[model samples]
Target chain A: MKKVKIYVTLRESVLDPQGSAVMGALHTMGYNEVADVRIGKYLELQVDDSERALDVIVKEMCEKLLTNTVIEDYRYDVEEAVSK
Target chain B: MKKVKIYVTLRESVLDPQGSAVMGALHTMGYNEVADVRIGKYLELQVDDSERALDVIVKEMCEKLLTNTVIEDYRYDVEEAVSK
Candidate 1:
């Protein structure tokens, strides 16, 4: 099996309220050295080995549903899943 | 400055409904090759140089807020933030 790890984040130009909230919380907790925070989504997929390439399948999945192309950017890492 | 990338995921035994829902959707969309789906949280933090080590600060943040250590696992990657 193959494991695909995807990371999706809001575009830099967009405001991230959740991130800001966390940053504020950190500051309040006395971690004043924090400069910024951005929160995003991480997804892991286990897929059966297919005749087609895994990258192609993953990219298609990301473009179709994993990310909103207009406002978010996504990147992925794929690795061989270890046998149990 | 330092950039820290954090990945947080539910422990292996935990049930992930959102992940299952996404897997179901992918199957319905004809991506039958997908076997399992797991979703998690990704966080990016930009931190200023501090008297304490970045790892210490990051671990404190993760343990206190970034992760729910009871049922979740977290790992992080740190790098120097590029100057604009």
Candidate 2:
């Protein structure tokens, strides 16, 4: 099987309040070294071996359901799963 | 500066309804090759150089705020950020 890892992040133009809140909390906790924070989504998908190009399928999924596209951007990495 | 990428995932024993729902939708959409799906959080943190060890600081952040040890597990990758 192949495992695909997807990362969906808000576009640079979008404001991320959650990330800002975390940054604030970090500062409050005395982690003064922290400069910025951005929060996003991570997803793992296990797919059976198929003839279709994995990248094509991944893109389809991201555009159709995995990401908003309007406000978010996505990237993916695929690796062969260690079969048990 | 260093860029830390943290991934927080639900423990295998924990139920992931959001992942299940996404899998169901994929199958319904005819992406039958998908066998499993897992959803998690991705975070990017930019930190200034410090005398303290990066791993130690990362662990502290993960334990104190980035993850819920009881139900979630977190791992992080640290890399030098591209200076712009």
Candidate 3:
């Protein structure tokens, strides 16, 4: 099996109100050293070996379901899965 | 400045309904090769230089604000911030 780790983040130009709210909370809690915060989604997928290339399949999944391309950008890493 | 990347994930025993929903959607969209899905939060923090050790600061932040220790586990990586 192959394991894919995908990170979907807001585009640089997009406003991240959620991130801002967290940063504010952090500051209020006395973590004044924190200058900024950006929040994003992290997804891990376990895929059974298939005829199609892993990268191709992952890109299609990201485009179709995992990411909102209009305001978010996604990138992924593929690795061999280790049996537990 | 230092850049801290934090990943907060559900504990192994916890149920992840959102992940299951996404996996179901993928299967409906014909990506049956995907066997499992797990979702988490990825957070990036920019921190100004401080008197405390970076790792110590990060760990405290994770435990106090970035994560819910009861049902979630968190890990972090710290690196020097790259000026843009």
TM-score of structure candidate 1: 0.98
- Which regions of candidate 1 are displaced past 4 Å? none
Task: Report clashes for each candidate as comma-separated counts.
Answer: 0, 0, 0
Instruction: Compute the lDDT of residue B63 as modeled in candidate 1.
Output: 98
In the range A1-84, model 3's lDDT, one tens digit per residue, is: 999999899998999999999999989988889999999999989999989988888999999889999999998888999998
For each candidate, the alpha-carbon lDDT, in order, equals: 0.94, 0.95, 0.92
What C-alpha RMSD separates each model from the true structure? 0.8, 1.0, 0.8
- Candidate 3, residue B56: CA error in Å? 1.1
DockQ of each: 0.90, 0.87, 0.91
lDDT (Cα, tens digit) per residue for candidate 2, span A1-84:
899999999998999999999999999998989999999999999999888878888899999999999999999999999897
Q: Compared to the true structure, candidate 3 yields what TM-score?
A: 0.97
Q: What is the DockQ of candidate 1?
A: 0.90
Q: Arrange candidates, best lDDT first.
A: 2, 1, 3
Model 3 per-residue lDDT tens digits across residues B1-84:
998889888998999999999999999998999998999999989999989788888888889888999999988888999998
